[model samples]
Target chain A: MKPHPLAGALLIAGTVPIKDFPLLLGKAEREGDFLLVDGQRIPCTQGTAAMVTAAVAALDYLNLDPPMALLAGDVGEGRGSRAIYDFLSRELREFSPKVLSLHYLLPIITPMKKVISAVQGCNPRPVLIADAGSMYAAKAAGLATEFDVFTPDAGEMAFLADSEATHPAYIKRYLFEADSKEVPRLIGQAYGCGNAAQTLLVKGVVDYIARNGEILETVREPDVPQMEAIGGTGDTITGLVSAFLQAGLEPHEAAIIAAKANRMAGKYANPTPATRITEIIARFPEAFKDHLCEWSGVCTVESRLRPATGGARQGGEA
Target chain B: MGLFKDKSSSRGRGLTLFKEVKEALKAEKILKVSGYEVKLAAPPPSLRKGCDLAIEVDLMGQAGVERVLRQNGVEFDRIVSIDTEELEPLRVVKVTDFGDSMMVRAGNMKVAFEKATGIILNVSGGGCPDVPYLHLELLNKKITEAPRPCELGFTLCALMLDRALDEGVRIYEEARG
Candidate 1:
């Protein structure tokens, strides 16, 4: 098989907008203190912190060499981001990636009033990027456009796809509602053909890549069940796509491979009972490029890891 | 005051297993008891269901604890037992297998810090990051700085429980639901 060109030097990143209301269970109650998970009992505050830690923990699962590359979204105080960053520095000395780059747009944090640099202070990774609303955060930190490439989804595309912009003449923010046939034409002529090396990879039923404002390529995710509705699906997709890039696949190839793998993973989940998003995430790796793809009539169960330390892992650091 | 001493089995309404009552004892040590199994029940106006009572033995299995209860003419259905192998919050919460995931309800509990903004959260868990991650996804969105409490995870949860309560935030039933 021909190795996908345009591999490595790849950075993957995405953002998670935690739900505003805590998914608390019951009425609020006072004991001595603490607004609990149930409002009546457990203490489970700090939602964004949970996700950031999750990302940090996810890094532990990486099959890295050294200076393991880390890529995750950022907010001011870098509160959660800072923890992951620090964790990488302190604990994980064994298998670090040669470089680290974030694949996410920065977001503003309140109270700070100043735009927080979500991806600041990361070592060895030469680029710090901003997209959409995070653009303001990046610029505030004086690191806007430091990146070799900037990637965004459709919603972000509209924000940057203005005709006034130099590269992609038009970014299709409304791609969802836009007629399908017209999409290729608009993306190709207006978005993909632009002079900007900066790319926007919009995730949808069909993943589209627009670079320098030109439509680079499109790969439809084959047989991806309705997994998008369950939150964090996009984050996982972005992670995989970036992983392919970091693993030496071209941006476009990364998109295709990630889309296929995500679909296959979801397809794997469709039949199983108690299919937790967590379970699918854990079943990754061996399910992806690892185990041989066995096409049993029932479902393709990927080859699992040779029995080792313990057993198949429940994946991710987060 | 003299709960857990009654060993005499009184067969009556709301009969719960020894395991169930043991869990209730673990939950609210000073629970009011009634009927068979001595299940924990809150006073009226706080009718949270599933409040059964068992021997109110101190957390550590005292040497004469079981004997005292047996000696004292305490009426109960059966002696509840808990393996304690998987007791999550051993210091605060213990589960006696009640034939199912032990269900606990907080009674006479007041809404501690509901509409209060600007609180701090601290998360702790086993070396595994499942609960901490879930806690973060669920809690950290609302508060500030619920960082990893410690290097040793078990202690982190203990600290988290204590800190949240000290700050006037009422802790409630863990949101396993």
Candidate 2:
């Protein structure tokens, strides 16, 4: 049988407009952080950092001259999420994308559910990335295993830890205090509860890449002070990982590279809390170069610590 | 939370089974001969609308199973999916009348034909392998003279096409009345 025409295509579904961020596109418009792409507006709400990051990652992938077709859609609130499902269903039935990233859409459960069903209904299923609201929705719907990877921050990890809560905000007594310890606890509980996502990139001061609740690697370097205060860093990491997935890297490798590249980008930018997300996004190419060079042993670590270790960080670097 | 749980029994999440044991066995033999993995299990009481024995197969293999069953003359009650949530009902069929032609739609499946001449014009749908062939076979033929979907189709897709055609004819007759 012939393979699908879109076997390795990259399809990004985000709340943010594709045009709003520099995104390395020729033409764009911003409507309150939403990107206007081909006359359709994509929302870049606080919940959609994952997808926004994915689009940024695609820009870096394009630099590699791979046979990649990047398709982006806006799915903010319920409006775009609703339309996205119908479009997604039609696309899945015809062309099979390599990866489908779901950012935001947490507040609107119905549309996200429909998209999950659509993805499941596809023949050669696409690799799914869920972050922010989409991650919450997938886990809440009991369809978390349907996705390939999840990019969740400490707070979201705490939310996944709570078996009873429908949303992260409702997780009891865990808000604003999602430190590194809760990361594995959340993975263990989520796995015990039947989460099928094989890999999780828990974004934090020390990025932990865990497979089935077992911590595989930790990328803790190039830490930029006040990086947590700056928005879209998590989103950038999700995007970077997605790009690596599209490039055919395994989930663990992708997460490690993505975390290292994102931190490197931050270190190069050296942004205060005031540094805009676009400025950080623009540093991705440089980050990718430095991080890849380090991985390939082309670049020496001038600092005392290596970027990633197979287990937890050796010293308090972050 | 049991997304991948082996709920084939509790949820009736497998191939459609028949009330006739012969049909069920025949389906299993045919599927196995076709190189498909198939097993016979007692139907869950909740979903046992037909026979006692049901074929347990992966939901992903449904289209192939249906085609093989239809080709080998194996009858089934209905395909049961273990949906985690109650699915919204299939879209109600809609009939539209043009003075010389008519169109019928049920979900993604559609049937259109000329009213005055009864010449079938098109059959369109996706996500199923049979619909495209159904279009080829039904198109340009008189609706009354065309081969019935039950005779030609070997899967649920063929069943959907039959529904669209049946609805289209019913609406045509009502308009004539």
Candidate 3:
């Protein structure tokens, strides 16, 4: 089977690599004072998407056709590292992506339009697990509609469904405040590239995928003790969905694979709580292949997988 | 950029930390299954999710792991080792530790994490783009509501190596009994 040039979402996440104080990720978890990766010394700032983008962009410039990127950044010593977020938004826009995806975000929400414009797309949409602060901005920006989605856990869903916030200051305060605890009846909340893109995906026993006002697929993974608190699990899912977008699978389809893959990967790596993100991404093609083969009703290549291709190093003649 | 910082932490013991496990287990004789990447990890309270990342070794007695890495010429500016719990990366350990349990833990963690990812390749599934896979136990049984209404799934997948192995024993006992 010939592999499509565009596979699911081409994930792009970059992060800062400085004293990753609160969280020591992957190999970073090993060294208490210094940061290590793939068994070598690396600066701690390497954790954020901001720093990671240089490599991703280099890969892209190398003609890597990954459409979605998860620009990640770990906060350094500061009250709020908006600099990292703003820097990512700026640097990422230079890539001129068609659509922007958000996982854990916290820059100015209104400036999303400038981003969509720079990306040069007709209708830009963002996929996120909507948080209390982002919901109103989405609505007011005319992007909070059914086209957008929110992947939150039960608690988040219940919170969003009831038009509530976990805490008044759980996150930093913003202009749009709701008093009644009900999803406020705001004015002129239309769905645009930016408005409705912010969504909340509440991670839980039964995963519920929803958008503006309707529920999408509710994919269920096998129950495992590890699912309870894996950081970047949802981020990985988001990245997976983004990566598959290149293959032309619907967002939901990509999401299904990502969700399942993450779960399965979790199962495979059980007990080792600190699994690196890049390590798992390396297996995407095979996992995709197996999933298709297992679920194929009647097929040869199987409906789940088309030929897997990573181009250049993996197989394609770079 | 304000993603991983939290001041409230006492910088406590990372119970499920696998880096230490890898350091402890390096140099252990192990198997790196064919057509799969190696995963490494450390000891934990329980076998939930594991491995630092797998080093190449042959599942049929260590042929597969080395062959693949060599074949792929996997590049690394460095292959650093670290304490599994604190993530305090240790001075680079020799890559020769395929016979140690700690090494096995590190490599296994990598493999397990990598393997668990991705979607069903079938167009019926992967076509959904970024859909995430709902986790299915590799060896343990788990119940879930299927995509269809009232549809239930009993998966005996997610497993601990010992439990998964014990399951085989239990199956034999039941048949014999």
Candidate 4:
């Protein structure tokens, strides 16, 4: 396998079948609801495809190298998942990405363990982010703390809070009933049980960024209520955070910014309950442009020319 | 039912409502087998009319209890939290017919099969890791002969797929009859 020396991030996700085996690696582009990569077209309507496509859009907006994607054709069957695990174990040694995001895959413990081991052994260990099935598998296998960040929705958060529950379906009924309002308690339970990563980006009506069991930040502004019901919006937030991490932002910071940017994207999309996730993803560039300067602490030309006032630092120094 | 009439006694407890007493009893059994502290009780008269029962569980274990019931295919109508407001059970399954083929979707998980042969045409959706395994297990096989998704997988997606499979099998059988 050729090395991806310049690859800042790697997205490992699965797509609905198109007859590809092992893995397909390349820069990705969204054409309609399909993610075109390495001479293959993967549907982006949901799951890993939606997440990777949203990440690619954010990376493109930031002018970073498009994420190196490792995709397998999986429609729930373990073939693509097994292929991904095998590829990661055998080929991850050749690539050294700064950010590694794991998305949809079947939660198979043994092979997943090998892949995690391989990832841990990488030189200059990459920042690990897991969402969807990857997060579920990591938490289920008791390896969630090894990752840098976990992006979970309220439903998934309930799973994390119930240390004994291996999957969301089995989370304690009380925790699930608590819903979004009980996220802080769930975060505490997750961290208390050591089932959470170093940081958690909990997506919901109000996005919470927690690190080390402390709620560091919560972003509720630019609230697009309709975004909650839209499939793949949570996936887009994971994608945005992964790109921000690739851009050298701290996990917590990346999570906060991603949450805000996602909402802004939703606002830009002017989404209704009927809006498609792709429509929201399409506004990522504009969303990033609107907030990147402030979020990254970069001075715009106009801000750079502003005079210092009221003991503020000169030259637009935040 | 009179035992639950004292509202204060129900504090910090949630009720899993069911359309029938049998479903409540089944849910209680499933939750107990899964190690949850739950009881089948008559709901307060104000909560429901008729002879239906409710499975009361510690509010703290609601998510886990519900999950176990769902995984076991023991359906309930809804879960009422301590607030007395109805928390509608997620009814995510939908079926679409394409003449020879029929597709059933439960949440993000989808399963489609040939109506006449009961052969699964495709298995798709879901972000769970076991999906690939379940997909491989169900695809290109007769739906009736394949292992049920919940038996082979552990995630909610698998349970949802199992629901789809159940619906698919029912549709296929009814068509043949």
Candidate 2's TM-score on the B chain: 0.69
Which model scores highest in TM-score?
A: 4
Off by over 4 Å in 2: A1-7, A17-36, A39-77, A174-178, A296-318, B1-177
Quote the B-chain TM-score, candidate 3: 0.16
TM-score of 3: 0.41
Candidate 4, residue B173: lDDT? 83
Considering TM-score, which of the candidate structures 1 and 2 is the better prediction for this target? 2
Q: How would you order the candidates by lDDT, starting with the best? A: 4, 2, 1, 3
Cα lDDT of all candidates, in order? 0.31, 0.57, 0.29, 0.70
Query: Model 2 fnat?
Result: 0.00
Distance (Å) between predicted and true CA of B145, model 1?
27
Root mean square deviation (Cα) for candidate 3: 20.5
Residues A1-318, candidate 3: write the lDDT tens digits. 432233322333233322342221221121322324334443321122311222232223223343433322222112122343344346543333332344333222334334333334322332332222223223323434432344433322322332222111111122122222322121112112233333333344555443443345555665543433232344445444444443334555545555675566556555232333343433444454456334222223223323224432233311
Residue A313, model 3: Cα distance from true site in angstroms: 8.4
Residues A80-130 of candidate 2: C-alpha lDDT, one tens digit per residue: 343444466555656566677765431334455667777887666788887
Tens-place lDDT digits, model 4, residues B1-177: 111111223333567888777777778777766666577777877677344688886542343455577778887766665432323323445566665677776544567777778988666555665565566677679988888876666445776678878888888888888
Task: Tell me each candidate's RMSD, in Å, in order.
Answer: 23.1, 18.9, 20.5, 13.5
Residue A90 displacement in candidate 3 (angstroms): 5.7
Model 4 ranges off by over 4 Å:
A1-8, A15-22, A299-318, B1-126, B129-155, B161-177
Where does the lowest 10-residue lDDT sum fall in candidate 1 chain A? A164-173
Looking at model 2 chain A, report the run of 10 residues with the lowest lDDT sum: A304-313
